[model samples]
Target chain A: MGTPLPRDPIADAQRNWERHGWGDVAAPMAAITAIMRTQQILLARIETVLKPFGLTFARYELLALLSFARSGALPMNKASALLQVHPTSVTNAVDRLEKAGLVARSPHPTDGRTTLIELTAEGRTLAKKATAALNSEVFGNSGFGADDVDHLIRVLGTFRRDAGDFTEE
Target chain B: MGTPLPRDPIADAQRNWERHGWGDVAAPMAAITAIMRTQQILLARIETVLKPFGLTFARYELLALLSFARSGALPMNKASALLQVHPTSVTNAVDRLEKAGLVARSPHPTDGRTTLIELTAEGRTLAKKATAALNSEVFGNSGFGADDVDHLIRVLGTFRRDAGDFTEE
Candidate 1:
């Protein structure tokens, strides 16, 4: 949804160190620290915006999963694995989504202790709308052209895969 | 510093939907949601590891910034801008970094209202050690290699400059 940083030539590197708490550190560390700091700043802004919609990143993730499904449904256990969260977290998230009327949980056809969570039509519609708004609200401000956005996705995708993201276990 | 995500891709998608409220979203929207999710997961994991050290991402960021600066000193305004936070967040972050004996603040040179902050040697040394540990924690898990770490950094770096960052007034 956004692009890279420092719209202006960045201020002094040494000054950045003092500000971010690296205080006279090297360039690499300074750069990393700055990234982390900016990351927090951006996420906080996104969080506040999503708050009014009753959506957290966690909830949004769940909805995305269901919408992508061919039948718009998946088993609870299956969803839990993909999110990399504990079963309990998945349970809680699903409960909230269900309450919001964004997803429906039905008895699993084949698995015990697992339910099938699917997006209702209304849920699907909301997800579509929110997706656009989320894009505009979070990254749209950057005024990224198609290529910039595409590059960001490809890079982030590589990053995610490289960051020791868990495979199905 | 990330927890293992479930192997189930379906649940993973569902998690996005539930948390972000997305359904039938475009690749761009899905991509942004995924990036945001990973950041949270990574930060949470980082917080867990750093907890025993009495540090958070914010603290680590400050320490690293200071460690990179000249004699570990810099002015206040730059800190706010580099960290991409309100001046107040910088103020509070420094207050904590100072109280922790990681940083110190002094009167700004020739400026009555401004201040300068610097990291102590203890902070600098500690930052190095903590970073080493952090690197291992990041690398030693999830069956990822240094190449993967490098790739991840590259991708994240792409986003770092690609855009979507908000500016402060």
Candidate 2:
């Protein structure tokens, strides 16, 4: 949004926090802010790669998840749980995907109370193409070094589990 | 958003990537996905603490930045640069803050064309209250332990630098 500053703003904020006598929480504050900023950067990169496919990260994620599912389908709640997002969000994404003819909602045959979100043939194709683009353009050249990627996966894995995102198998 | 899954969805996504022969990019994919998820969790926590103060994270950041300035005011461009957000976003935040009587805008004293965003008395008090609450509720009990926090700060500092967010001083 502007020219790079000579120093990191988050680090400066950490110093300010310490100077204000909130030293105990300063580090975590900086860490959290950094995560926020980093996510912004990475999401920009990801959305750029996905844009040609007309997918936002959230929608791309749903398509990718469905493409990987056993029958190219998941119950709406199941998709929401696996994505760690609200069910309403899944419903919104499905609505958009359905409108675009990428996916369809159907009554679960045996479990009449449940709805299944199934990828359309077009959805499966788009998912594969969008994924290849992300793999090549974003993930393959993700800013972190290999070791840093490993460290982040481990550290944030613990953080997510602690946040009750999931339990170990 | 639902019951915690039996396994981390990100790790499962990594397996899916690998199975699809995206082996080289899988780790970074998982890492990036984890960061996205972590940001969501942390933002939810931060916003919960901020809501009572009538601030979202973006507004709180601007107010907090103004509160830290030498005279509780900064040129609009300066605030935008420091916040690493688009100037348009700064304009929007300033618009809301001014409407709420939390901040005011004035022509820059020395620069005829520049605008300054200054925290009002109410803004300063609100900022302090918000910071204290965040320090207590979110930062103090941040899910990451001290070591993880340190690691995150370092790793993300490097990532930010690599992304051209800033240069080391």
Candidate 3:
């Protein structure tokens, strides 16, 4: 529906690799490039979707995580681990969410050295609305149908597992 | 070999989604999250490989691009387009590469407004060696064998095309 992509640089790179007698090495190069480029494009689309909600994907993820919690709260360290980002990034996202009145930080009830993050009522409401919007507008419409999406997840899961992203359970 | 990935947060997110009556939306969320996390892992691996060469993936890409050029030179605009990065990113990368003495800029022979970036002899030599190193280490040794690598590129290519990353050729 949008303007078609202008060119395929990965394919061009592959051709160049072949011409240079490096044909065997071309696939990985193109694959990595495509993965990187796709991340960029997806991030941009996500940013555009989240802009109206006054949230970035990082903050949105934090809010969503809290909303999903049984107590609507999580320790900062737990949040960091769950989000698969560094503590500093978690701290930064929490700071932004707090400033936006979507999240609050409190001392963990039992842990002397831990801080817990909770979603405010406003945050909960926003998270719900934002999730719905994203589901319909971005995630649900990601172009790949259910079958392709499943295949992508399966293959990428293997790639991630091999990269030590997570132990296969 | 490295510390195994502890757990897949994306999978947890999917379970949450299913429990929250958003089951249908789980696939895209997991897929995008996997893509993003995989990119992070790949970048980390790439960074490790490039560190010895005093290069980051961004700088390596610029050098590799110039190395692929017939004249070992290309305009900044062209580099930006080919790399699928912004002009400022190109400028920053070029600035760093120039300071590293791996790249040099010269005025375009006929176009006053265009500047050509060329790999110095040192740059060219390093590019060659680095390419070889990456081929044997990170890129070539990426867990996916040739078949899986090709399959990844094909599927991701379709995804990117649908995302409007490039016009179908």
Model 2 docking tier (incorrect/acceptable/medium/high): high
Q: Quote the positional error of residue B60 for candidate 1 in Å.
A: 1.3
Q: Give the candidates in order of lDDT, highest first.
A: 2, 3, 1
Candidate 3 wrongly placed segments (more than 4 Å): A1-7, B1-6
**RMSD in Å for candidate 2, one decimal?**
1.4
lDDT of 2: 0.92
Q: Write the per-residue lDDT of candidate 1 for residues A46-74, one digit (tens) a residue.
A: 66667777887678767866777777789
Q: How many backbone clashes does candidate 1 have?
A: 64
| First chain of candidate 1, TM-score | 0.67
lDDT (10s digit) by residue, model 2, range A31-80? 99999999999999999999888999999999999998998789999999
- In the order shown, the candidates' DockQ scores are 0.21, 0.84, 0.58
Point to the candidate with the largest TM-score.
Answer: 2
Lowest-sum lDDT 10-residue window in model 3 chain A: A1-10
- Compare the candidates by DockQ and give the number of the best one: 2
Per-residue lDDT tens digits of candidate 3, residues B66-163? 99898779999888888878889999999999998999999999999999999999999999888888888877778776776877788789888776
Q: Better model by DockQ, 2 or 3? A: 2
lDDT of 1 by residue, B47-88 (tens): 877787888877876676666666568787766665566788
lDDT of each: 0.62, 0.92, 0.85
**Residue A77, candidate 3: alpha-carbon lDDT:** 88
